[model samples]
Target: MKSKNTMFLVQAATIGAIYVVLTLLFAPLSYGEVQVRFSEALTILPYFTPAAIPGLFVGCILSNLLGGAIPVDIIFGSIATLIGAVFTYKLRGSSKWLAPLPPIVANTVIVPFVLYYGYGVNLPIPLMMLTVGAGEVISCGIFGMIVLTALSKVKGSVFGKASYSK
Candidate 1:
C-alpha cells in the first residue's frame, strides 16, 4: 500500500513536470486562440494508468500557471483536462483508438467557449471547433496514438500488468 501510494505520487509529479516542460516548449503556440499542445498526447496515458487522473490535472494546473493563462482559464481549463482524464481512466481497456477521444472532445467543447469569452475572439463557433478540434486530433489523437503504441510495447516494464488491467 505504501509503495503504491509512493508510486502514484511519483507518477503525478513526473507527469506534471513533463507537462510544464512541454507547455514551455510550445509557449508561443500553446497560448492564445489556437493551441497545439503536443504534450496533451500524455492525456491518453490515463487509459492505461489511473495515476494519470491527478497527474493530468496537476500537469494542467502547473502548465497554465507557467503559461500565464487568465485565472478563469487556469481554473476551468484545468477542470476540462481533469474531467477528460478521469473519463479516460474510467474507460480504460475499452479500445486503444478510443483512449484519446475524451481529451480531444473535452478540450474541443470547452476551449472554444474559453477562446470566445476569455480571449474575446470573434470567430464563428464552427471555425473555433475546427481549429481546436484539429489541434486536439493532431496532438491528442495522432501523437497520443504513437505514445500509446510505444507504451504498449513496454507496458509491463513501465507500469506493470496490474496497472494496465481494467
Candidate 2:
C-alpha cells in the first residue's frame, strides 16, 4: 500500500519535472500567440495514469511563472491545462486517437483570451485562436499522438499495468 502511494508520487513528480524542462528548453515556442509548446506532447500521459492530471496542472503553473507570465495568464492558462488533463484521464478507456483532443480543444478555447487580455497581444481573438489552435494541433494533436503511440507499445514495461487500473 505504501509502495503504491510512493510510486504514484514519484511518477507525478517525474512528469511535472519533465514538463518544466521541455517547456523551458523550448521557451520561445512554449509561450505566445504563435507558439507550439513541446511539453504539451506529454498531455497524453493522463491516459496512462491519473497522476498526470495534477502533474500537468502544476507543471503549467510553474512553467508560466518561470517564463514571466502575468498573473492572469498564469492562473487561467494553468486552469486550461488542468481541465485538459482531467478530460484526457477520463477518456483513458476510449480510443487512443481521442487522447490529444482534450488538450487541443482546451487550449484553443482558453489561450486566445490569455494572449489578448493577459499578454496584450495585438492579434484579434479569432486570429489568436487560429494560431493557438494551429500550435496545439502541432504539439498536442500531432506530437501527443506520437508519444501516445510509442508509450502504448511499452506501457507495462514503463508505466506499468498497475497504472491503467489506477
Best by lDDT: 2
TM-score of 2: 0.96
Q: Which pairs of residues collide in candidate 2?
A: none
lDDT of 1 by residue, 1-166 (tens): 8998898788888887887788889888777667788878899888777787888898898889888888888988888899789888877867778888899989888888888888789998778888988988988899998998899878877775534532
Q: How many residue pairs clash in all the candidates, one count each?
A: 0, 0
Give the range of the ten consecutive residues with the poorest summed lDDT in model 2: 157-166
TM-score of every prediction relative to native: 0.94, 0.96
Q: Largest TM-score belongs to which candidate?
A: 2
Residue lDDT tens for model 2, 28-83: 99988999999999999999987788889889999999999999989999999998
